[model samples]
Target: MRYACRPVGLLSRSDPISRFDVADVQRFYPRGRPPQPATFDWSFTMNLLGVLPYWQLGPWELGPLTLHSFGLSVAIGVALALSILGSRGQKILGVSGDRMQNFGMWLLIFGWCFSHVFEVVAYQPHIILEDPLVLFKVWGSISSVGGLIGGVIAFLIWRVRNPYEDHIGWSNVAAFTLPIAFFFGRIGCALVHDHPGADATNFVVWEWIRSIFGDSLPEVWPLALQYPDGVPRHDLGFYEAIIFFFLTLFVLYKGRKPQRRGYYLWTLPLLYAPFRFLFDFLRVTPGEAGLHGDTRYLMLTPAQWVAIGMFILGLFLWSKLRNEPLETWKGLEKSTSDDEEPESSSE
Candidate 1:
């Protein structure tokens, strides 16, 4: 696309900038400015076969199978809740103890707010008229992008409050376990077919999918494919699962290494953002505009915009703290210093 600069005033006037076209800049831009990738026909296969176990859980039927999802949900809720409270209690014992407590607390508050805000933004009309309790019960509706934002916010809060606790190190270990939670959540999404993948279009993509699943794609019911009202579903879950699979393996490989204070948590958003941005293309959105690229140079879907903003913010904070080395011995040193102080007996 040929790029042009417009006067600042012209940009302010909607009509002038509205006429700008990104395609016009294509001819002038150097070939391969954006690298091309080898095309694959695995999308369909991924969609159909990747989600086989999920489909076995009937949507309308409430039975033992449903218990699996409820069980998974309870596991995550309990784990997170315990992490937050458990970590906080540990922090209370000393001036500066394990930073995990503060980190967990930040995650709870920020993650809750961001998730709710995105949910409210995505489905405002339903939320506005519906009781708040009802909204919580609606299982398939919370935004992953919002959860990502919450995690990023949590990282920033940790950095500001306790910059010295760097020894907990890169969040790779925490990140490794996170995908299992995601895997379970995805299983839930697939079981409910709660969030449908994108509509199949490419024959290669479809054919590759059909070979593995054997006609299951055409037979899957609409209830499995449909999204909640006011939102469009995407076929990106399979892709997400694939990425997380590799990520989990990477984390396992590095599991023996100790992470710095903030590294384990912050890595989640950094690794997750690009996929979220790219996956936005496969799904339908209300009114997404691409004045430059879909990465929101101009207009973007709510989720996309949130992803971009969070990605930038997360990157900035990561960069700021990237150099700080975690000091494992500091806690012991501080304790020793405390013990050396003169003791006074109270009358």
Candidate 2:
């Protein structure tokens, strides 16, 4: 979607464009009742079809409550995913409406919590152990791998109680819902300017986004690339948004077939790992706080190693599904005669 420049936090939180914009930045910060200041400087403007052009759109107020844009994007992702799964993707999700609703709720809760835990554990596990308050920090960031683990945990817990459902497996609904969340979550990341790329002035956000879909961008579109510091670098969030968006589209197409739903578990990792493993080379992150693979050996992120694991897991899972037939498992594919017999859908 289009981002309106409503500030999320203080200028100190995100690099201020210039000293002149400090007053303007303060005015837009999510907190405080500062006096009105002069108009914002040119450095903060984004020329998206002559738009309101601010980088954020705010802590929207609903009576006494306030909702941040990042939270809004994530909420939108979950809501849209549930809505789609409930109305359009029941077959793909392989659950009835009620169960889909339940699964979705658990997935969101566990997945969201785990997403945070994954990053915190990766970057700062000591903080979690030293201070228990870290668990309550809802505003903290999410990790993709952590979210994946959490959601799977949730699915398994749900499955243990409701074991009769054929679609209740490690790969089914989790695979279907994840990319959609990832695509939308990346939008949140881009809106917040959290995922920065390496020192590269050549790739503008919109231009690089265009290039992801096979459009050829110029050698250097001067003035086209701009960040909070007014120095252009790679926009990893935007890059991921495009890639995951296409992935969402692909999964949508693939989800129509019942058998294809099973493949998404392995397929998604295959698509994500290698490309992102290489992609990390262009993106910088704190290597020291992470695992050995990420910290040592010239700064490869933990995500890269996770990608390698995912690649291997995908291969194993693919081979298993290939060599094994579900027909051997009782009641996997029910016959027409069985439909006539009265039974719970889960059964």
Candidate 3:
């Protein structure tokens, strides 16, 4: 069976400048020099044996509100991540639920707001130049890398205000739980098929995947989507979801054992950045025929530059904290109390 789908609500064609169609520039390009439209097939055939299933889920209407799948997934991911963070903070670091909730709230607010800012400033500065008011439209667009930077800023601000808290331990907890949010967020991207890539019909990895799945491998791998021209192309979001699925499992398993205070915090970026940097190469470029790609700076996508920075940050963390002692729940609790003692005495 085959299904053809088109986005509605936030990602609908009604908004020529919607987040998913950043490459569609027919409306904004210079006169007489409009770029080729990057169109893709919204229809795909179901293959029981395919390794990945293709589907596009749009938004739903609830009275006056239109609920987007991507937004809902992000909300669920945030809720789940915060729940885990709160439970872990209380049990491991002797932190109160209220404190943890406050931290999470700030992190979410800053991270979400800046994601849109970065989307415009880094990925599409022209949007802001065209209309400065677009900067205030936090729901207009977002960049995952921007969210990470915003989270870091939130952490820094929180650390300054709560000097008595076990900030390092909290960082560890965040490193362990943040991937859960990332995995689900990427799933939302996959469902929307927003991050289209270049043609992948001849990608060699599929041969190995085919060998392993045997008859289970679909004629068209779910990782690839059929373009309007009938050629299969990689879907970057689908690939990222697959990567994060394994990453989440690995971190959760490792978190079971006591680790250094900055172990996962430093190491995850080291492990993930290279892959992200490489993946950006597979993305379709602006001038690519039949497909619109991401905006690039000096030939590198914004995410690619962010990946490089992440790698450098990871290396710096490793150099600074590699020698730190293993951290345990009891140890962290005691450390937190020790930190609080000075403030208590002064008060």
**lDDT digits (tens) for residues 190-248 of candidate 2:** 77766665545444554575466333333343322255554555566777887899999
Root-mean-square deviation of candidate 3: 19.0
Model 1 spans with C-alpha error above 4 angstroms: 1-54, 58-106, 125-140, 152-177, 203-234, 259-262, 265-267, 285-299, 326-347
TM-score of every prediction relative to native: 0.51, 0.66, 0.75
Each candidate: RMSD to true structure?
A: 18.5, 16.6, 19.0
Query: Per-residue CA lDDT of candidate 1, range 1-347, in tens?
Result: 22232322222222331334334224434455631222334345435533233234433445654445534553664375445334323332233324454455466457656676666656453555756664455343466666656665676766677677532342322344565556545545554443344443342444675667566454332222333432333435545666666665665565444344455455666777777776665554333321111122254556667677767866976886577565243334556667766443321
Compared with the true structure, all predictions reach lDDT values of: 0.49, 0.63, 0.78
User: Which model, 2 or 3, shows the larger TM-score?
Assistant: 3
TM-score of 1: 0.51
Model 3 lDDT tens row, 1-347: 11111332112233344443443343445555544433442223235334344567878999999998988887888888888888777767777766776778788899889999998898778777789999899978888999999999989998998898778888787777788989999989987877888877666677677767564445555567775556688889888988888889988888777888889889899988998998999899876865657888899999999999999999999999999998778746677899999999999
Off by over 4 Å in 2: 1-54, 61-63, 92-94, 126-132, 136-139, 167-170, 202-217, 221-225, 287-298, 323-347
Number of the predicted model whose TM-score against the real structure is largest: 3
Model 1 Cα RMSD, Å?
A: 18.5
- Of the candidates numbered 1 and 2, which has the greater lDDT value? 2
Error of 2 at 252 (Å): 1.7
